[model samples]
Target: MSWRFVSLPPQDGYHMVTSFVSVADYVSRGGRNTLLVFSVKEPFVNVGVHQEVWLEVDLDYTSKAGIPVVRRDLGGGTVVITRGEHDYFVVVNQDEAPSDPKALYAKYLSPVVEVLRDYGLNAQLKDQDIVVNGKKISGNGAMTHGKAVVLAGNILMKLDVDLMSKCIRVPTEKFRDKMAKDMSEWLTSLERELGYVPPREELDKKLKASFERNLGIKFEDSSLTSEEIEEWERLAREKMEEEWIYYKDRRHPELRTERCVKISSSVAICHVDYKARKLLRITAKFLGGKLAEVSISGDFFVMSPKGFIELLEERLTNLSPEDIPKEIDRVFEEKKPTIFGFTADDLKKAFLEIVNKPEVREVI
Candidate 1:
């Protein structure tokens, strides 16, 4: 079988390329060996197939900044990508690939490592990540579609590290200034590692050579067939839809939130510890909601759970008399939870009724 190399121009093109490659590989009976590599414009938060977007992201921040949130069909931790990141996707027949996942990475990413080495950077595969000097520069994930396995990853040519940190919601107190400094020191970009910005075409050529040498296959430059192009457009449109990006699972409610106040979702009941400023303990009673349970144990810290309750009280004081469902829908839209079978508005109304009065303010 001959290998086909298709270079997709950088755009909202990653999803399209993957879909087309999967279709071609399946329809052609593994006869079409293809490499689909593309880049995307604007930063997007791509989550795993099973991840909850709200739990994985700070939606308030992402929405205000105009960043798009995408739930990919693959499984992995959430990844932030921008125009600078170089993305690679490979579609191979499972029959041709070794059964072990590590072997798959070795087969595809070994070429990437070779290309980085050619550029004077010591790049090696560590598990599934491509690391340069022990800091991860690339992360890879894969999923099976029909008879094909699609492996995709991005090379950190240049990353906006600060924006990436902000885009993904990590408990801020966990990383002190000194710890943050130490963490930043570990990350290395291609420009930083190579001492200069390499031309895009040059980088692509290096990758092409690496694959050819490592895989013992020749790559012929090819364009998408008419059927493939049509498929790509259809997939792209589907990806761009809000419903697909936001709520593919029917079990996920429209919105949910975690505050200092005592709030119960259909799945879990949360009680925050005021002194700890984090979740004291969460009891998950149902499985339909995305989050099972969360423990604020160990060294994790946040605004006192009591403080969060006070904030909720203040925010909901004027709405105590409002209709329940209307309030729930409004709050759900505002907070946008991935758990809590009910909406944010519903939680607010329920909490107010449970307390029987607004919470008193206490100075922290």
Candidate 2:
């Protein structure tokens, strides 16, 4: 059956989120499956439904800047969203959607990757986020909305590096600065890739076209049903309550550390910092039993090509346990990057020095 297509009118922070959740509920109650797309009318701090806003958001900064902190019905890290991001949601009957989160992301987001690649960017589905040239272009998450399942994601059009970093609570200003730099390197947008933001009207047309081609489903033009609207209105008010924003993300004070900690029960996030003549900060994510994302940032100087560190970081990924040293050697030999205060061997040691445990407990 063709999906009921609703292009939500871009509005303030709350309704932008409630629209999809309401649609998902409608689907749960035997309404038609939906493909929904919309953007926010203003920038807002979007907290995951499960996140503790106190830990995830800089509430003071947000209040000062007039950016509303919105809690969405999804699972992901906190992010700052502006109209520059285009959001897409697949709201369907639970019976029709994949039960596994990975399956859900792969099925819906892979097609968006194709759409991105068509615009001359080398895009791929790497785990949950979509990336282009090792930089993430999208954030995605899925959750059951009542009896229906809704998979949601955003096409990051232009990331506000400074604001994004500032809005998140970090251990220190240094961490926030590192975060801004890391985001500038690792996260990307259509504006950065294409040299100009594409027209929204054109983007809107192409977005649906890709879904039709990729999923083999027609989208009937539609609007929110009266029932969905009422639900949206109710949710819009409820989500604004303080209780909803900080629903369930409090940890023990002892559990709080300067370094990264747990995202959920299963995931452990670790940030390794080692100080020598020069500082090195490593943000690592592993996939397929290999290094997936390795962002090395600090006051280190490299004398190869202009993009030597970026090249090194890229090559360091997807390496096996033993291949790391070999990979480091290959990069040093091939690129011949000279450091003012560090040697290639030092670089290799620094990487190995921190990654010496089963759980990534500490770094020297």
Candidate 3:
């Protein structure tokens, strides 16, 4: 059946979040139909559901700048969304969507890649992020809500690097400066790449056309049903509270000690940082050309028991550098562990980088 579609009118950040959630519920209840929603809300700082706003965002700056901080139901690092950027949300029945999150991302987000390519950008999905010239151009995440799959992300018309950097509550000014510089280089936008923001109206037309052709589904204009409106109100009241935004993430704290140390030629310790739908930080030590010990820690959501992650790490220890990926793949396949917004491959690549370190550095 054709999916119902809605382009939500621009509203405050809280309304936008609830509207998307409300629409996703349409599929959760045996509706059997999907929903494609496009929304752009007022400028706000949004943090992952698990993240503490005070830890990652500068509350003072956000308050003074009139940018409200919100906690999204999805899991990911903090992000800034402004008025003009495009935010796409796809709500599909789990039975109709790919069972695997990785495949689900590639399937639904392919049209987005097509749109970017049509504009002459070399876009591809790499490490789950949409990248061009090895820099990220779009960010995405996927999660299951009841019987529905919710995929959400943004297409950058332009990015405010200074504001993005200043809004984050990093440890020091030096770190903030570095964060701003890195964002400017590693993150990009359509305006930066094409020299001007494309007409959003035309872009919306292209998106609808591309999705129809790629997903083999028609989109008919639709309105929010009375039931969804009620759900939206309830969710807004529950999800938009200050306590939710400031809730502490129980994941491992930032490693304060040295993360890298060189033991000798071909034997060293290294740390690798990776991101997909969630942050992944890994610490690995190599000895005798094999993994001696490794630890995986981050704010990523793990549905397994508390010790499951440790067991996965233990299963990988002492494996050859080349064999780590295969083992990680096997564990994920057999356990069917759920880490929201990430795949086994995303975790493997992070571990491999440390094992494949090309240069030795002093303790960090």
Best model per lDDT: 3
Q: Pick by TM-score: which candidate is best?
A: 3
Candidate 3 weakest lDDT stretch, 10 residues:
249-258
Cand. 2 Cα-lDDT: 0.73
TM-score (C-alpha) between model 1 and the true structure: 0.68
lDDT of 1 by residue, 149-219 (tens): 67778788886766677677655745534444654787667877876767777777888888888888889
Which scores better on TM-score, 2 or 3? 3
Q: Which regions in candidate 2 have their CA more than 4 angstroms from the true location?
A: 249-364
Poorest lDDT segment (10 consecutive residues) of candidate 2: 249-258
| Per-model tally of clashing residue pairs | 8, 0, 0
Question: Best to worst by lDDT, what's the order?
Answer: 3, 2, 1
Per-model lDDT: 0.59, 0.73, 0.74
Error of 3 at 246 (Å): 2.0
RMSD of 1: 12.4
* lDDT by residue for model 2 (313-344), tens: 78987775467778888988887754433566
